[model samples]
Target: MSGPGTNGAAGAPLLSIEGLSAGFDGQSAPAVQGLTLSVKAGEIVALVGESGSGKSVTALSLLRLLPRSAWIRGRAEFVRESGEIVDLYSAPKGTMLSLRGADISMIFQEPMTSLNPVFTIGEQLTEGLRLSGATRGEARERGERALAEVGISEPGRRFSQYPHEFSGGMRQRVMIAMALLRSPRLLIADEPTTALDVTVQAQVLDLLASLRETRGLSILLITHDLGLVSRVADVAAVMFRGRLVEVGPVGEVFARPAHPYTRALLACAPRLGAPRKRLMSIADILAAGDGPFGRTGRSPWMPPVDGDSARGDGCVLEPVGPGHSVAVVEPGEIAAGAEPAT
Candidate 1:
């Protein structure tokens, strides 16, 4: 997987998203509103947020996988293996179909539901390769090799088995193998370890990290677990209510979070060897107003800005440090970043 151009070189981002917003039909507000982020080649960037915070919608929007009834507005630029950059939002359906599974692939959260119950493992693995002009014999060899690469022993036997025959960990490995069959430059992993136990979760995370190093792969890891982000990600992007509140190197953001939401998330993480106290909930943070910052009257649920337009004078993302940004509301407005009264 390592090649001349595969190394993490200083160049344009592999994937760049800006001003993205998506909404289903009959909905007035978008699920993802004005979101912006980027993933560099050979790097792991984790997008962290709770459920309904638009993390999954952002991924689907980039892949153009939403249904016809959904409306999307944004620019998702993907750099092709051939070094060509294309706007995914405006690209033709044919172009997108060709790019999917080859240029950019995704491993869905649940393997049981992601894998076809009716199709054999080999059949599902070879489907994309066969459609992309691979001969049956070539596809079979590659599929078996992929299974082996994913640490599955007896690839031949596993290839013939059905989805139900495999355990949860094995199924996840299969999903990773399938996603990597085409050697995509960018892989989007949606909560890859959500269902696994702590031990198995560590194994999967190790697998992903190894793949990134050996294959020079870039990954967009969507998860709500800061523990996972701290373990595997080089950069972390925090989302709140469909908006990106902060993004920076994982260590910096974890050590000195600038946003109130981020601080609350860190404070809620369970510490080892500490008193087994009641876990702090997001609701508690909201009720705390200023949250851990203790700025009186500052709540997580601030005034809702107009979602129809982009950021204006009412709010701005000011730099707090190198590569660290925090969204700040204009003074005198009841915003998420409202300061305490004197």
Candidate 2:
């Protein structure tokens, strides 16, 4: 396994997270607890949930990008140098510094914050490429190519333009270009298409798919849009609160959801072939039950009586269809999972 085969086998799963729980309060109960997920080479795994579900937190914890005050737990194994695993939580600062953009890169939700408003888009993009070992000239060349790859025309002049000069969609393309500057094996994209118009979003998604196919980059896409997730993800993980409620290949999960929470979520979405008389609303869920997860629902792990002091009727994640897992709990219990907000 020296060439393409080596890349396929060796470049597999740049990041793996197991039982990860992290938060700013450093409480025993993490904002997202007992989270287990992975990103494989050339694959897209979508992490979907409503607001406050800990999807973004999960990504931030992986890069150690959270504030110093926060406490992160669990083992994050980053594969590098052929079969090596590094614990991101307790790793030395040096390990973190090296891993940040080289081995695994991340694209945050907001381009304005991630990109320096003061610097021209070109300068910002060039800076990242340079930091990863590209010479200034080479970085410039790559930056231009990156912009073009992301569908930004006139990449050379745009390089000298600040973020303010670009439209929201253009800024997103710049962010994507910056993230793609290097041949990163894993990319954690937290709502990369947020705030973009529908047309722009479609373009960006297409660009992402093409880029992924060409480079075989593993992607962790965190978004609230189940439709978007279905478009890009090979597998989907649905979280509630801070727990994983269900996970499986995209098609199976969409076709026949086993978990009651899942059924409720899907019922909320507009089905192309089904009628749209009713939409699932959180308000309905809140009113129907005694707990935050809903009291009268058909699932377990519902929220506590007051949204605090959770009722521990933990549901076991059971397989429904092949390659699909759903948490099975008592009828009155709510699903204990984090909801990743937009």
Candidate 3:
């Protein structure tokens, strides 16, 4: 994992995650495993992968928001504006509460469900601010300004309205505003543009970029859209089946994909001039296997295909270039089907 917190001499990262793994109570296999990445100050690092590829799991693990049934392991360190680094994983419950909305905030994927149906926008936004030591009046004014910053037309009026009164785009903006109102040093945005139209998605992304410039906020953006990542991400991390297959500068990773999974994902993206065809699924690529990727290292964590436990962790992440790494997956490493046969 990039040796923790270091971003190739770019100074310390805002958030550094090292070897994080998580599994649900009833699940034999972990949802995420040995995931490591970093988001530097005033930069956007995007975590991109297909659905169920552990993107959301990594984000939730950082916040410790997953259910109690889930067991999480690893270290997530957040560097505050004060230059104090706090490990989120083992920090006390009280510390986590104080950091949640004040120093670190998150904008969940769906605003409709995230926002309370019965509460006014003002109430919802100011609640966190009030808890963070602001008076009711101070919180109210700040909440309105937050709304305006995210491009809300009538911040004052909208502040009094409930979540149902806002359109999908506006609702998403409100979510963004709520997250930014605390003036957090780091923001975890889990699929912030999901369900929004392309135009609205662009607008939301622009707002995030503006926030980064204006507030120097570090952002961890989790999404499946490569186009969106290319537009705003400074660095990109690609995950497949709970493992980070590749990570590096956005342009470099896109230009010279080293991992077989990364190459397949690029091939699957729809291009304007390209013909409409069934996109190649990850399963299809895995089935093709060594035919495409030569000299792959197998992962020891993966369950054996033939019900043999002999194969240890066979995959190893090797540096392919400066600030770039790819998992060399060996033959028989990724067994047939998403899960190995029992």
Candidate 4:
């Protein structure tokens, strides 16, 4: 696999999103607003935030999986396996259908709900292949191999079982296997390990990492787990209330968080042997006013503003270091001054 931060070929991003926004009908504000991010081939970019921070919404928006009531606006350029650049937001329906499972696939957070209870594992696994014109026999063979590739023992036996017959981790492994069936170039894994135990979580993460190394896969891992981001992601993007607050290399962002929300998130993470203290909430961080957390004159959590007012009323990402940026209401504040401790 290519090194972290390096694209697979020619330094071109596999997926690039800019000024993306999504909002459901009747909602006064968008679930996601003017967000921009990119994923390079063979790299894992973690979208980390608290629940309802719009991370999953961002992923769903990319695939056009959101409900019809949801409206999306922005440019999302994707490099297909064929090297063709397609704007996902404007792609034809047929093109999206052809791309969904073949070029890009998604593993939803809950495999139990994602997998059909009545369908045999093998049948579900091969369904996509069959629809894509593969013969049943060929599809089944590939399905079994995929099961084996995901570390499942007795692939033949497991193929005949139902979703209820497998453990949570096993079901998740099956989901991963299904996602890999078409050898997608990009995998959107939304909280892939959320429902698993700690050990199972580690196994799944390791499996994802191994897949990237073996298949040169690019993954967009959406989760609230900072620890997981630190462990597996090459880049970390933090979100809050539907906006990107900070993004950078995982190590740099962790070592020097420039946004108040990012600092609050790191402080809230459970640490071993650290003195126990009441973890601060996002509201607390915002209400802290112009203290250490708010080195800038105003809090970054001010009301959202349009492009015309962004400079004075809203937050914009500012470069704090090479390839590292944090959102601040005033540019150059965090980039120039010392950041607060977590």
What is the TM-score of candidate 1?
A: 0.87
- In terms of lDDT, the poorest run of 10 residues in model 4 is 304-313
lDDT of 4 at 201: 92
**Tens digits of per-residue lDDT for model 2 on 63-92?**
888987788778989887556688888889
Better of 3 and 4 by lDDT: 4
Clashing residue pairs, backbone N/CA/C < 3 A, model 4: none
lDDT of 1: 0.78
- Candidate 4 segments whose C-alpha is farther than 4 A from its true place: 1-3, 6-10, 272-277, 287-313, 331-342
**If ranked by lDDT, best first, what sequence of candidates would result?**
4, 1, 3, 2
| Predicted candidate 4 versus true structure: per-residue lDDT over 156-240, tens digit per residue | 8998899999999999999999999999999999999999998899899999988988998989999998978877788899987
lDDT of each: 0.78, 0.73, 0.77, 0.81
Query: What's the residue-level lDDT of 256 in candidate 3?
Result: 81
Candidate 3: segments with Cα more than 4 A from true spot = 1-11, 287-312, 329-342
- Per-prediction tally of clashes: 1, 22, 13, 0
Per-candidate RMSD vs. true structure? 4.4, 6.0, 4.5, 4.5
lDDT per residue for candidate 3 within 1-342, as digits (tens), equals 131222354446788899888888987678887888888777788899888888888888888899999899999899887887889999999889888878888888776698899999899988877876899889989998889888898888999999889988899888888888878888999999988998898888888878877887888899988778877778889987778878988877888877666777777776668875476754555543442234333432233334332232456677777788877544566544423211
Local accuracy of candidate 1 as per-residue lDDT tens digits, 43-133: 8888998788889989988889888998888899999989889899999999999899889999987766888899999999889889889
Estimate candidate 1's RMSD in Å: 4.4
TM-score of each: 0.87, 0.83, 0.87, 0.88
